[model samples]
Target: MYERKQEILTKILRAGRRTYFFDVKATKADDYYLTITESKKFTNEDGSFHFKKHKIYLYKEDFNAFKSILEEMTSFIFDKKGEEIISDHNTEQKFINN
Candidate 1:
């Protein structure tokens, strides 16, 4: 028998190397649904920082709509930004080593 994981009211704030993700996690009243938030962080040379957050509230009824929009947005960003290729070696190794 498979059991479902217990869902709790969670606030996940993740900070990555370049970005931050702040998610106000919640469940639907009756239907099984969830909401997520994304926050991007920017840093200045003066050691100041700022964040821009965008949230998506998803409901069970709007799953398809949400998925479609996500797909479209991701595709658009990829097409516009192109792909980033990272070289095997650290390009900034010299500066760091010195």
Candidate 2:
């Protein structure tokens, strides 16, 4: 069985009900890699809640290409929408009814 590695570095970003964790960990041979995890909170019907986590593991070799594509995609969105959180999901129903 594979054991979980300890994080050498960590960063957290909380956005509303979702929290993102960025962690840097090392392999058994001491090679470092990153893990990006998104944990979203969900409320149960009985007044309890839980978090659903999704994670991605990124290695050094793909760093450049990954960063380039991420930057390009984000820049494209900013160029078109200009950083405003306009007409998000909450307004969808209102828009449809109007």
Candidate 3:
């Protein structure tokens, strides 16, 4: 039934210019685990390309440690690499509404 499929939960823990996806899915024994995915969209010279994804699986027992490490790693990267600004100078939010 559709309800059975809906039982699995997925959430995005963090979203930046580089997006990360955290998804919870089932095992053969029906146990739950996490899948972490990094997705980056790119454009080719021809102007058409797809997102590149790198994924890793983490089990329930490791969730706490994994979350702590993930937070530390991203913090280190942010400290090392400066932040980026993305803006559309011509289009304002009110203008879009108008």
lDDT of 3 at 32: 88
Estimate candidate 2's alpha-carbon lDDT, on a 0 to 1 scale. 0.84
Give a tens-digit lDDT track for model 3, residues 44-97.
899997888999999989989988998999888778875543545432221111
* Predicted candidate 2 versus true structure: per-residue lDDT over 1-98, tens digit per residue: 98988889888877767777888999999999999998888999999999999999999999999999999999999999898777555322111110
TM-score leader: 2
Candidate lDDT (C-alpha), each: 0.56, 0.84, 0.68
- All candidates: CA RMSD (Å): 10.5, 8.8, 7.5
Please state the error at residue 98 of candidate 3 in Å: 30
Error of 1 at 34 (Å): 0.8
The TM-score of candidate 2 is 0.84
Task: Give the poorly placed runs of model 2, Cα more than 4 Å off.
Answer: 1-4, 87-98
Compare the candidates by lDDT and give the number of the best one.
Answer: 2
TM-score of every model versus the real structure: 0.43, 0.84, 0.58
